[model samples]
Target: MNGSAGAIEGCYWQADRETREVSPALSGDIKVDVAVIGGGFTGLAAAYHLKVADPGLEIAILEAETAGFGASGRNAGFVMTLFGASVSMMKALHGKERVRQAHQYMVSAISALEAMIGEHAIDCDYERTGFLKIATAPAYISLIQDEIELFQSLGIEGFEWLDRDQLAARIRSPVFLGASWEPGCGLLNPVKWLNALRRLACANGARLFEGTRVSEVQRENGRYRLTCDH
Candidate 1:
């Protein structure tokens, strides 16, 4: 996994990050059923889920630096029920039904994240206060309406159009024309969240290596040999 030149550093999220006992660097060669090449949100989440499903599975997560030393630790912690782009844009690309399914999946993901937090007792200050997608331009009203209609077609309900007056009642914004509010979204402390997940992964038999960089993974006899720097 020659993905980077060296270990990445923690950005602004370090202020919110909780200190913990650190894992040692990779020194000698080792083998496992699975070797995750990164220690960010993606890698740790994969390890945690895999171990949960199959407790006996041997897994290891390798990080160039400490876990959450990349974008995963540095991101704004909004667990939004959004599909990256707006519902209208998604409907235009993949049509109504497909976009609806995609949107529904994101909604489900919000709850799943909540459940996972409680399940592991990961206290990252999670809040299900929901999300608001607002439109400042008058022309954007039609697009916001399209979002509501798209969800209605999916037999799903929870989205509502909030006029400027209604929006201001919640958040006082000067340029807001209208907005779409969904109640299933959330926010959290990203660094704390990742660390909790990492702890769970470790407790579930997923070995973690910090300050260890894997430069390549070579396949030999159907087994992977990870080249590393301790």
Candidate 2:
């Protein structure tokens, strides 16, 4: 596995993390029931869940570099319930019902993440600090108010409008006009969470390979063969 410092140098999350052992690269041909490309959050979670569902299943995660060395570790790390750009935008694009369902799905996803962190006792510096959508100009105040009304029409709770004074109390900024506050929001360290997922997936019998790039994939007979540059 490529645990080299250069792989994690640019990302703040990965750079801040403590050094750990990296898994070895794939050596020679190997066979598995499932081959998951990329060792990011999605791949690791899929491997872990698949093993949980069926312990006998064989799974291997292939990564070009070390895990969490991509955007998975460099994101803003906001565990928010917002879907897409805005509620108004989503409703206009997918209609009211679909937007409501999407919002609900995001809410459920945040809940599931919290549950997983608690269940596994993952230390990721998680904080339920909530979210604030601030309006820096007078024109944006109406836009934010319209979004709040849209949320209300969709029967969504927990979102409220904070006037200039109220917002000032929370954050002392003169440029801010007003803001929308939602209680169902959180922040965490992305790289730490990724590392925890990697550990859990490995413990659940998922094999991970680093510095192993897949060059080609083809079907031979009834099985799929992956060509890699180790």
Candidate 3:
């Protein structure tokens, strides 16, 4: 594929806007206190948080392409509290307490994200429209009920079972039998949110290098050295 093809191919988010200017690649050896591999949501958020915690820490984010060029820019932006495969699966695998903790963490994370967006004035078209895990079959109704019951059992509120009529009132969908409605959920434009994060990380003194692919990393005299493609 040619340059810009990856950005245009599968990412509707990137394709919707004008092409973004990529940051310059690494030209020579550089040193930093921390070297972040990718420039996706996780990396950008980590860099931002680290800088906020310690403004003197030197951080660098190296990305193969531009920031948000990967799944960060190309995902259905559903900011819900569903961890792992399902609530039941999480409970089965990690027990009830862990599931509850996970749910609470996700809730806190969503709230923090919303607060950050407001504080930074990030224009990502964020909307707390809630989430609906709709049940299309009668059997799935029982599953939804079980999930809601599990949430209640775990002391996790903000979730309710919406019957067919109630769900239809919210959304005129004939195929939906019922849905697990979580009022704390939200949606946003992923690419826009990522771009905002990129800007915030840079503004907070996080150096970001696009088109810089890390080829190898080695420990040298108790410190780390990264080799990147030229």
| Ordering by TM-score | 3, 2, 1
Clashes of 1: 0
| Total clashes in model 2, counting residue pairs 3 or more apart in sequence or in different chains | 0
Candidate 3 lDDT at 230 equals 81
User: Candidate 3 on 1-230: residue-level lDDT in tens?
Assistant: 23443354567776677666677778898889999999999999999999999999999999988788788988999888877998888889999899888988999999999999999989998999999999999999998899888889888899899999999999987798989998899999898899889989999999998889999989989999899998
Residue clash pairs of candidate 1: none
Candidate 1 lDDT score relative to the true structure: 0.82
Cα lDDT for residue 140, model 3? 95
TM-score of each: 0.87, 0.93, 0.95
Please give me the total number of clashing residue pairs in predicted model 3.
Answer: 0
lDDT of 2 by residue, 1-230 (tens): 33544247667776655677778889888889999999999999999999999999999999888888778878999999876887878888899999888889989999999999999999999999999999999999999999899999998888899999999999988899999999899999998899999999999999999888889989999888999896
Superior candidate under lDDT, 1 versus 2: 2
lDDT of 1 by residue, 1-230 (tens): 22332223445656544456668878887878889998998999999999989998999899887888787878889998766576667777888778767777887888788888887788888988788888989878888888687778767688999999999999997999889998778889888888888888998999998888899878899888999985
Against the correct fold, how does model 3 do in TM-score? 0.95
Winner of 1 and 2 under TM-score: 2
Top candidate by lDDT: 2
